[model samples]
Target: MGKVTGFMEYERLEEGYAPVQTRLKHHKEFVIGLKVDDAKVQAARCMDCGTPFCNSGCPVNNIIPDFNDLVYTNQWKNAATVLHSTNNFPEFTGRICPAPCEAACVLNVNDDPVGIKSIEHAIADRAWEEGWIVPQKAALRTGRKVAVVGSGPAGLAAAQQLARAGHDVTVFEKNDRIGGLLRYGIPDFKMEKTHIDRRVAQMEAEGVTFRTGVVVGEWPKGSKITNHAKETVSAEQLKSEFDAVLLAAGSEVSRDLPVPGRDLDGVHYAMEFLPQQNKVNAGDKLKGQTLATGKNVIVIGGGDTGSDCVGTSNRHGAKSVTQFELMPMPPEQENKPLVWPYWPTKLRTSSSHDEGCSREFAIATKEFVGEKGKLTALKTVQIEFRDGKLSEVAGSEKVWPADLVLLAMGFTNPMSQLLQSFGVDADARGNAKAGVDEKTGYKTSVDKVWAAGDVRRGQSLVVWAIREGRQAARAIDLALMGCTTLPR
Candidate 1:
């Protein structure tokens, strides 16, 4: 460690945000990351624990202590190398990951944990600025063809790994751009699309081919999630053309609230509203874009997506925003002794929550009340869990005015039609059936086909998606060459 007593001497310093009023006027990243010196100091706070739980806590299993020590010793370039060894896209994770690694930190038992995410953000940004990040072209060609479907974190990671291993890798994205959800679902206010674009350029240089606006299988007809695909390539074509196929298409079907008036004009899935804003940010003219301007917005479901809705609505100058959560409000702080070194149940207030919004907990919408086929209000009631069953409270029914209702509930599963087209079996939860064991890791029910990320594991964080992608790539490499040097 650079400073043995650094933990005792320093307090946790979080990245700053732009002023709410000023940031609302434009869609851009607002997080002010740590300076070089500050990042070094933050890295110094990493204690000499016998086991670095932060490594296990992180989905990608980043070498946290090694990077922390490297940063503390002023070895910025080496830190970036160590970071990239585990994570293909540290910039994406640094900006959006919830940092469960921090929750599992040794220091978090009694004090604030090291600012790992901020340090990672700094290291990646500095690496790019110093030209430490560049294309890693293969030394020789493997003469194998790999088709990776979807261009989100998982697919990108897999394609990069396979390409670096000398395979002819091609990524297919249904959206007009390379990044699947990252290019459209996430708002620019969180992370600009330039990050994705830069990586796409790097991957292209590494000999990975990107085919945008190309769907790999039959998209379900009339499915809202299939709106972006301009061209469809049958599953048979990919199977016959490629040596192997990796399905990294993320879970896209948003869970629906099948209540009365769900068919109302103003009621829409969060995806329906979010992608339009991202497209507009990318300079695309949306003829009938969904906007929250001067309207009473009601965001159903308390999660990252709901918080994103809150932030986007505020940026659109909504008259008012209210978020509803079916679960009861959690404690402000966790009981450290009871839940040490693991994610704890506690209240989380995002930057969006701090900006402005009303949050309602333990509330369930019974019906969407509207007039003339347009949403107007919601009939809701307080709920409670009793004897492992949810029951509505008597005499707690109420109606709230709403002009736009955004259903921000999480996704249920991947588009089943795509999986079925390739004859891949689905799990009980509707995710692709695949095992993560070393013997048959990421292999789908169908031969020569594999699945990873949200499509295989259900919806999850970007960090997890990257991890699955890397591991799946290793599995494919092993299957192809009878051995693989790539890390699992």
Candidate 2:
């Protein structure tokens, strides 16, 4: 709880963004975070609600109110301590998380919710600047070894947690660099990869070993899942080598549009387009890097990936950018009373949208129009729901010129070949079927093996991945030591 009557006295403040003209020139973070005084004022707005749904709403279960009060009282050191207690990387969630915790804020019932995210961002940045964050080397080493496949948030979180718990942790990443989804899936404008780099350094200091460019199992052909893997390790090798194993890869099987001209050049998955730009930004020379410069870019899908495409395209000096949404657009604002304390269906406009992009809702891409194996345009039609069934509207079909088409339709599941190589069983949705239960605890059917994050639960938020990773680490520690002190 913050100030007793602060909610009634102060108005909500939001994080600022750089102007489009300046930001479009480069792919770097443009967010202007709250200053110390501003963060204190924002934190003061937190009310002492008897039931704090925000805690439950957060995937990492951050002690939002406690930290808010600490910030309000200018107790930055204690605030950082409280924050780092539950969440391993508040900086990641602070920048990229949608802040479901704010949506579930007690004050959000009627007024603007507390600026929890902005405050978190401020705290994390300040903590880094003040040199308060450092590697926590474990005093005692457990002889147990944990092999975490994938260097995304989930794997990284699990690895860090296990390392802090005094276990030998080695993380495997197929990509040449670490941070799987965060490294490639997200655009630099939204979250600079440096945040990930610092954490990796900290984890390394903590004795966590990260082996990048090491692919576990088989890398599927024609996969857009960013494989710069120079080496390979079989599942059997890991199972025999490590005392325990965690399959924490991201859900990277992009959902394909099975339409005519699907194989046309200049059309690619969002993952493929995003990673190239990231590589380029990092000074990596890509021979045939996909370019949207001077081209009419059509981004299919209105989710975060689509927004990222729009932003990346704009940075590439694209002639035009248009995003398509299959479902009808929701209301501009959610009906709060109807969907309080939960994620609501509402039209979300990311900074990418503000950077110049046209958004079309309730549309379907029927086919890709091409000329000589090169993409030219998209044959699309407006869609409508009738009798609880989707049907295309008549006389609404149109062909839009598109020199570059990016499929941001999202992922279906983790790489099936990789999962199959490990003999992991997937659920109906093609996610590894592992439960977060007291008995099973993220364990797959295989012995001494566990699954967590997107690979097990399908594509989800980074916060969720961190939570699953931490919890699974606790489970594994308990399984290994018979008893554990790690938090769930």
Candidate 3:
């Protein structure tokens, strides 16, 4: 807990952003982090609640109160230590996470909650600047090896935890670089990829081996998922080589809109559009790049993916950007009394949304209109949720000019072929079948093989992925060494 009277004394102060006009010129992070004194004040807003719900609200279960108290006392180093105790990467969550902890804050019952995320961002960034964040190499090797597929937050967290637990760890990524969604799915404007690069360096120093551009599954036709493997590692090979294998591969198969004109030249998936901009920002040459310059862009889907598309399109000097949501619009603010201690329903306006865009809800795209294989417009209709079913509103049909269309409807499941290749049974929603049971923890049908993160749980946040990775690492360590000291 922070100061006893701090909550009543201090008002909330939020982080700032660069003007859209200046930031639209380039693809880079424009977020203005909180000042040290201001962050301390914000941290002081944390009340001494008898039961801290923020801890449970956080996916990684970060010790929020302890860190907040430490920050209030200006014990910066101790704050960093406490912050990193549970979260493997607070920096990532600070920038990208929707911060459900704030929703669960006791003070949020009546007013703005404590700025936990800004304080976290400050702590992590300060730790790096003060050299508090460095590699902690294990004293002795456990003589156990773990092969983790995918270099996303889950894979990276598992590898780090297992390596620190004295097990040899190797992380494989299909892309030419590490950090799956962090590197490619997210735009640089939100969180620069350098945050991932530095963490990769630290993990390397901690004795974790990273093998990039090594695809783990069978190739999908006409898919953006790349296969750069010089050689493949069969499930049998992995079972024989490593003591245990953790499948941290994320759910990557994007949901598609197979409506007419989907194959139009100007239409593309959000993943395809987002990653190319990231690659270009990293100085990589992208052939046949998708640009929104001087074009009317229509981004389908109202999630974070659609927000990213809007931001990217603005940076591309697009003529206009519009986002569509199938569901009805939510209230501007949540009913806190009814939804307290849980994520509430509310309309979230992201920084990307603030930049520039038209947002429409309760709308459905009937079809994509195009001319000679090139996208020209979209046919849409308004819909209403009635009698537990969505019905099209008569006389609400309309056509909007669209030179580009980006589908950001989220994902359905993990890649099936990869799961089948390992003979792992999939759940009803196509995720790898695994449980949190200690006896059979995170293990699939096959012995010596396990699964975690989105591939096992379903499409989720990076913080959830990190938690799964750490928990899976603990399970694997326990299986290999007869016990594990790592936290679940």
If scored against the real structure, what TM-score would every candidate get? 0.98, 0.98, 0.98
TM-score of 1: 0.98
Query: What global local distance difference test value does model 3 have?
Result: 0.91
**Regions of candidate 3 where Cα sits further than 4 Å from its true position:** 217-228
18: Cα error in model 1, Å: 1.2
Residue-level lDDT for 282 in candidate 1: 93
lDDT of 1 at 310: 94
Provide the lowest-lDDT 10-residue window in model 1. 220-229
- How does residue 467 of candidate 2 score in lDDT? 95
- Per model, how many backbone clashes are there? 0, 0, 0
Superposition-based RMSD of candidate 2 using all C-alpha atoms, in angstroms? 1.4
Per-residue lDDT tens digits of candidate 2, residues 128-186?
99999999999999899999999888999999999999999999988889998999888
* The candidate that achieves the highest lDDT relative to the unseen native structure: 1
- For candidate 3, the clash count comes to 0
